[model samples]
Target: MSFRPVIISLVVLALAGLALAFAPTGTTARPDQGDARPFQLRDTEGNLVTDTSLRGQVVLLYFGYTFCPDVCPTELGYVARVLRAMGDDVERTTPLFVTVDPERDTPELLKGYAPLFHPRIRALTGTPEELAAVFKTFGVTARKVPGAGSHYLMDHSSSITVLDRQGRVAATIGSTDTIARSVTTLRDILGKP
Candidate 1:
């Protein structure tokens, strides 16, 4: 008749529920296995960028906003390093920076921000409704965190979604993955050494 065991079981169950609630969406699919959800958004030049338009190239897609103080820049820096390390092989790759905060991350601002990391990175944004569809397609979650009046921060997921030549998800690099790891993943997808 010990209630200790029952209390421990309840606590464990609670913890499991919490973990499930906060877990990120999306399944990690192996190379060339899962079909990437299609999307269309506008690039910095007001050009419509779509999944179908990038069929023959490998894509490195990252989601974040220009105003992100640290994490976004760090992740983008890693992406730039990976591109540089690719050498001539970079020509076959397309690096994309998709803004999760379209309200503030206009194409004009993104045009300035993206090239600061690398000349090849194309920044994109779209209408809020359009962005929401793309976000769901990529299993990206973004929320606005209220800060001081008239200013706020966005809380969002950080990860790189790698797509192969066929526009299918080849791999998903975690936020903590190193540049070397990211390069390796890209190479594997690109079938390069």
Candidate 2:
């Protein structure tokens, strides 16, 4: 028994070391832009959606939970600020809010939450499997933790993904930047085509 425990500890340490050695060392990892595969996700209306649904526009995707105490609200506010700065020019941009905590964030909940931001913004949720698939494709990681009873809180990447008219990820905007820069960057991308 002692020998087995010792061996297990060594194996665990080795695995940890390997993980640290190979782990990515940045806030965002660039995806192969050439691999512009389309993805399907549901909107707050429970309607089926696809990447093409966002054609002829610049799409901003933010993965977060409504229950998020601080980050979600702040980021959404930033998005709102950016939109406000754009004024009428914001028509060509679409902002999507994907809830990482789907168990509690239903379509009805999103209906109430999404409108709190700019009118152009929308919120979406799907089954765990559906969300997992989309998250993986977007390289977003999320998890739910116990809180009280069946209730839980979620953690996810705060980075926002910006997709061009071609439905390809053109650039990523993190939470670190000011709303002004974010709006400028988005407008610059929209000006391209």
Candidate 3:
């Protein structure tokens, strides 16, 4: 019998554990404003980009690997749908896909992968150490675990951290949130009163 199913089950269970580590105990339901952590990483084009450079834009940052089985693809697809529905409102936003598995998710690989979700998506990656730094700053942890033979998967925190026009983390929506809720969260932060 193949161990693939068992390994996939373990990966899902492990991901749940990692996700619980960052789960909030607070009752606060809305995205709160706060200073955004700064980190420099290489974008799809190989140019260095910093959190500070994202000021004046609503930045939606998601940390996951390209190989993520479901959450990554589903969330990206949802974000793409939201962006499409937003029409020109997307111009004021900067959506970033930061890879937790930088060892295999190089700039070139991400360049090809990110746009599949949204045309404006900018994929970011860096050296393993650099990726570690951002993960630390953002209070997320992801680790590779043995999967089926000669393969592995990453278990990472599951949430989308959204920054406001000032580049501060103004809100956080669940990775599994409905598209409407996700859009509302973004609009609340990025929209005019």
Per-candidate TM equals 0.85, 0.84, 0.79
**Model 3: per-residue lDDT, tens digit, 1-193?**
5999999999999999989997743323454555567888888777888888888788888888888879999888877887886767799888889998887887778989998888898999887778878877776768789899988998787677888887777777765677788888888888742
lDDT of 2 by residue, 1-193 (tens): 6799999999999999999998744336775556454777889888977788888889989999888979999888788888888888789999999888888888999999988987888898887788888888788878677889877887678888888887888778866897778888888888876
Judging by lDDT against the true structure, name the best candidate: 1
Model 3, runs deviating above 4 Å: 1-32
Which prediction has more favorable TM-score, 2 or 3? 2
Give candidate 1's error at residue 135 in angstroms.
Answer: 0.9
lDDT tens per residue, model 1, 1-193:
6999999999999999999999766434333456656899999888899999998899988999988989999989888988998888799999999998888888889999999999999999987778898888877878899999899999887888888888888788754787788778888889931
Give the root-mean-square deviation of each candidate in angstroms: 3.0, 4.1, 8.8
Clashing pairs in 1: none
What do the candidate models score in CA lDDT, each in turn? 0.86, 0.83, 0.80
The local distance difference test score of model 2 is 0.83
Model 2 TM-score, all chains together:
0.84
